[model samples]
Target chain A: MTVDLRRAPAEKAVAWRRSPAGPPRASQKRQTVIRQRQYWGRLFVLPAVVLVSLLIIVPSIQGLYYSFTNWNGRSATWVGLDNYINGIFLSPDFARIALNSVCVVLSVPFGVALSVIVANLLANNLWGRAWFRGIYFLPIALSWVVIGITFAYLLSGRGPINGLLSSVGLGMFSQDWLGGETSALISIILVFNWSYFGINVVLLFTGMTTADASITEAARLDGAHGVKMFFNIVIPQVRRYVELCLILTMAAAITSIFALIYTMTSGGPGVSTTTLEYALYTRSFSLGHFSQGAAFGILLFLISLVFAVVRLRAGVKADDD
Target chain B: MTDRNSTIETDTSNDVPLSATPPRVAPPRSSSAAHRTGGRRVGDRISALFSTGLTRIVLVGLAAGTIAPLVFMVFKSLTKQDGTNAVTFDAWAAVLNGKLPQAGLISLQVSVIAILVILSIATLAAFGFAKLSFTGSQPIMATIIVLMLVPGQTFIITEYFNFSHLGLIGNIPAVGVLYGVTQIPFATFILTNFFRAIPDELVEAAIIDGASYPRVFWSIFLPLARPAMVTVGVLAFIGVWNDLLIALLFLPTPGSRTLSVVMAGAQDTRTFDVSQVMAGSLLSAIPCIIVYVIFQRQIAVGLTAGTGK
Candidate 1:
């Protein structure tokens, strides 16, 4: 492929030389320009290549190697599959943590649904639509630490949620939202959706604009309205966007809930809120089990890899269309 | 696909009835049709009004839901935590006068450095990928895009091991470098897409004027890509400023910790003050929120640039 791409410009130069109007010197100059461009391209990309390789690529490979060995920060001994088998799979807390991760993944559908609904609603020609978009997207501006701290206070026993419930005489419905094992996980999921659905809404709204307006109008004239129109006409049009949202939400849930879990629950209330990423941190950094942490990291990477591949394939297909 | 079939069915049904109607009864049919259409217009008006009202209500509710938590955070930061209902500025005062300002300064320095590094490296790479054709460019670009999806957490352990071995764990600029490197993939992706949209004729015109490649990039591409550069810079700045993981892992000491790390640490203490922590959280979030409000359009463009047509 590289060879073909390289030779194509040269072939074009040769074709130019065959034309009576094209002087030989101009073709020679064109070849030199192509050579200069190639040289500049390589020069410009050099720094990025070096930095990414040293920081990301090299360490990732080293991490894969470390996952198989008993590497404790200092020295390493080849322990084969012991870290994966005994350190992770056989550990008592692994099942619960994996379950927590699964729960996070399950929340993606709800988030995607909310985003699609909200995006559809906002897609209409309405009053203050831009203001609503800005408001919905406000949380994306805040850091995860700030979000975690804000929610940690909001879901506490004496927080405004319970306070409002008590004032409204529905106090029984209000519990410590982040206090229990199940409640903490649920709270984390809810917060995750709340914070991230904004960006999804933006993506889906962009998708909605790309829908064939004439087709939608045709569908409307054919006795389709409201839910039927949305599901049958609009949803089909934005299917790729919906898929993109699902993959992004799932990937985020799997990998990027660290700060939220750290601040809100600390994987606490007896490890009910601990996802794989959180477990990776605790086992490796806090407990000094570096190899075990490496193993967990690999597990997390593999899970995310599935979504990445799906997204890449979808992207390629979209490009083809 | 189902909608297309439904559309065809409705089309044929309406078409067959119109074609089968006789011309002799057209006048009477026209009069009755006008009456039915008038009544249907009124009904349609009412339904449109009703649906519009419903949409307005739902939008208002969603907007309120989005803002309520941030508002509550601000309110909690101001009020006393003893259920006394007395408003106090002590938490804010403490956050400003205590360790947070210093932490904020550290975060600012790190972000500034990261943005500089990202802007310089990502812009050149993006321009190269967009305008200059070279051997292996396609594969290299694909690798960069793939790296964009891989979370930084996957490599944190290895980075820690490496950084520790190099005795650079607590180095502030090293953290900035790591932050800058992780962000290069996304920044380059956005800028490359932006640069590719600019017409190639402009580059050829500049070249025809005897401008060298670097000169063309410096004078032509740089001027035209200013907005994209700003978008990349703001995003890179926000990303570095908002990151807690790298800052926490690398700069573990009290003096070098970023604002987020300090805020997280404050929350972890058993005797932590709730109002003060809330104030601190708000304090750390202020810079990012301000940046977001100022560069809202660029941020939106940068974010959705890759996802849409």
Candidate 2:
């Protein structure tokens, strides 16, 4: 379907004549073209390779080395395994941070389940489906800082949530949502779910759209409607999407909630809501424990590596299918 | 051609006749049974109506929950901070005239530069990976994937050391370059997938017409890949614009802080004005919301690219 505007008749005639008599010359030209293509290909990718090496790959290797040493930003002394043993095995603060991280990671299932229900509801030809999708996804556009600041106000002692609760005579249920230890972590988890719900819904809704429409219609006719059909048929069809949602949510919870924790509670009620990533920030930047921070970073990387392997395996399986 | 023809043959083979299988035999019987069980039908209909009504109510509630914080934010931004119910623009004025404009300008500069860097490098690398076969491509891509998988925090401390060694701390363009490089893996993944979907015939025809590889990429693939490029650029823009960690760590100076870093700092001080802070948060969110609204479709396509068929 491509327009061959540059292939003039004279050039074609010459190529035809040359090809019949000089096959070796034509092959040589092809080899030259291939070599040139290879050259250009390497050149094309050169900048990206250079930048990534300088910024990510080299720094990561350095970080791995630093984790085994007492590198306080400027100076380093070889103290192998000291940082890791103390940071992971001995410190009480590390236990709290690790537990908080686990709590965040455990919240992924609830977020995914809620997204699935909402996505299925919206997948039906409901009224104003597009508007609803937009509304749900609007939070993804806001930075975590914005969401965190807004929620910080909303969860404050005299905020609108409590105000409304008191107005409705449910005043006993009201408290400072982010002021206590357990409640602070719980509030952070809830906010994380709320902010990430939009993207998950969009992803799952896209998956639902890809389901075989005729099969669902047939199922509906056969009295397989509502919750039964959704669990048995729709979810099975979109299992890849559900897995994807889980992987993404886990990754976000593990590595990307620093801004959220920083803004909302500042990891407060005394490190109650401090995730590993936030702990790394405070340890290295706040407390000037660079090597300990690097150790935490390594631990976080190992955890993410598990999810990454799972995701890659799913990708390969999907490709084969 | 052989592949296409074989697929067509398989498609035809899959189209078995409906008459060869028993079909619609249960539907007619079910319809008759429904007629005999009129009360049961009414009960089913009532339950269905009730379920749909309940679904509608839940949907409305969810939508309200989603939009409530934003509404509250706007309300807080407008209301006077002196315990009065009257609406005032003082918060907006404070945000507009204060450090917000400076921070906003820095954010724009960083995001724009980062987007340009990401688009240029990512498109080239994607084209190479998608169309040009060369030695070590697989290993390089594998390394990139590994880098992508490892969280950015894994390298933050070392990056700080390296940047400080190079005296790039507080440098805006350097920070932009870091953001661009960090996003290259995802951007290249998106664009490579998009470029692979393009028919190879176009490249073959262009090469036969004596076009060089770069010319073919420049004149053919580049124009065709505009939508993918836009998606990558928008995503990169939002990412760099919304980042807090890099901005906070790299640019620690008061004058060099981004909007997010400024807001983070504002939230820390004890004696801050609540309305002004709300206005600042709203101001920072508007540009990203506008971008998301306009490119909503492309964004959805970009986000769901690898997970779907």
Candidate 3:
């Protein structure tokens, strides 16, 4: 390649302002306008681009570098693989938290299935549809802290579930909800479903609207009813939406659950509810182990980056299509 | 019976038709009558009735299950859930005194600052993406979409490092800036779709008329994109208002606490007083609920823009 380095493109010569003779020719002005647009366009986007880099990119790189060190947010020493080893294997709760996160995102299908049902129903020919949708999304609109505290109250030892159980003469079934190891994770998952299912309902219901009524009617005419029609016909047709739902749900699970966990169980009942995200919090802030926390953050970034890239491509492709 | 198609029709009719994420459902208008009364025969009607009945059952059940927590919190906050036989507003009153009010103030302050920053930056960025193609626009936009898609947990620790180094953590405005930056991608995404839907001719006319790019953006497109701007603003408001994890990490001391931080504190130290926590949480949720009830459609439109359509 012949390196002919010019500070400006060839268009710059022609794109400059023409003399004020002959009322400034249209073509020259057009090129100049185009050049102006490009300049302003880049300038307009620059602030945000800089902010994103300053906030996300630089910190991310620093986080990676610090992960290999023994930085405790205050001081530092180079420690090779120590933080990663301690975070993953040596630390008791780290592995469990990792497993817990995997389990949470792994359970995306459960939330999806549940929301799919409600969304389909919402999309159905039912009265009070608006009311139902509003109620469904009520939880979503509320802060995660509010929902977490509310559920924590409900699932607390002497809370409403027990109150209901005892009131119904099923007092024997009443036990510590958040206090129990097994129940803690389950409770978190249930709350997770409760909080997020609304977004999926909205998205999928919107998707369901796009389903061809003619095809559905044709299926109905062919004696395809209920479960068979929905499973074979309706569900498969909304592949794009299902994919979008899964992506959003997974991302929400990993990043947004910190509030819920922090308020609900504090990743407690002996680390049963701790996930990688929560571990990042305690490790960095509570434990003052910035390097380990950064390691966890890097791992989290890698996980999110893969999903993010896939989602980005999908979104771009969908837009292109 | 005919309500099925109406939701789809109504959803878009309520929208800006050229919405970046156009909820362009299949035009079911042509076949609505055919599908509805087509099923009027005895067996089909019966099945239809059965399904509608079934749908009602499921919807009612689902709503009950979903709304139970909210109802429970409200009820318990106003009543006595603790063993002491006293019905009182003390829990609500207690939270209202120093903690809840202060937290609410901090939250409002943070969200206000955050919203301004988000809207200003997102609008400008959206204009670049939608109207003017510049060098690296594609990659920059791709970077934005990727950033938006990823879990924010990835770089929060980095934020922590940055904030700690600058001694800026616990500063509400700094938290606001962070919150605002986090939302730039989504807001820009929603706005870009919104801005692109605007006719190119409009921008061209302004440019040909000698309006500068910024002038055209400010005077022509911004006005056109107001509904979208509102939608993006409402969405940003909700995200920042309800944010907990960021506030939890950044605002540690009670002096700097947002509502969520205060509520989380209640959950931590006052585990026995569930009523107080519930009351505090309910108070914190009021602004969010009010905003949501008022702007649910805009929020939905913003969230599903380009994706849902």
- Number of the top-ranking candidate, with lDDT as the measure: 2
Say which candidate scores most in TM-score.
2
Point out where model 3 deviates above 4 Å. Answer: A1-9, A12-24, A221-223, A309-321, B1-48, B81-87, B306-309
Question: Which candidate, 1 or 2, has the higher lDDT?
Answer: 2
Model 2 spans with C-alpha error above 4 angstroms: A1-22, A314-321, B1-28, B32-40
> What TM-score would candidate 3 get against the native?
0.87
Tell me each candidate's i-RMS in Å.
4.9, 6.5, 6.7
Q: What does candidate 3's lDDT look like per residue over B1-309, in tens digits?
A: 133344333433454243443233534443445666673557767887888888898888888988888887877788775566477998888777756898899999999999999989989999998898776688989788667754566678777767988999889898898899988888888889888888899988877787889899888888888899889888888888888888878988768988878877777673457677778888888998998899888877765665544
Over the stretch B1-309, how does candidate 1's per-residue lDDT look in tens digits? 345345534543454355433432233444345544775567767987898899899888878888898887788789987779689999899888899999999999889888988888888898889998688888998898678866777788989989999999878888888889999999889889888999988888888889988898899898888998899888888778888878889999888999989998898789788778888888898999999889877877776665654
DockQ of 3: 0.39
Worst 10 residues of 3 chain B by lDDT: B1-10
Tens digits of per-residue lDDT for model 3, A174-227: 988999888899889888977778878877887787666775665455445567
The CAPRI class of candidate 3 is acceptable
Candidate 3 fnat reads 0.67
User: What total of clashing residue pairs does each candidate reach?
Assistant: 0, 0, 1
Angstrom error at residue A91, model 2: 0.8
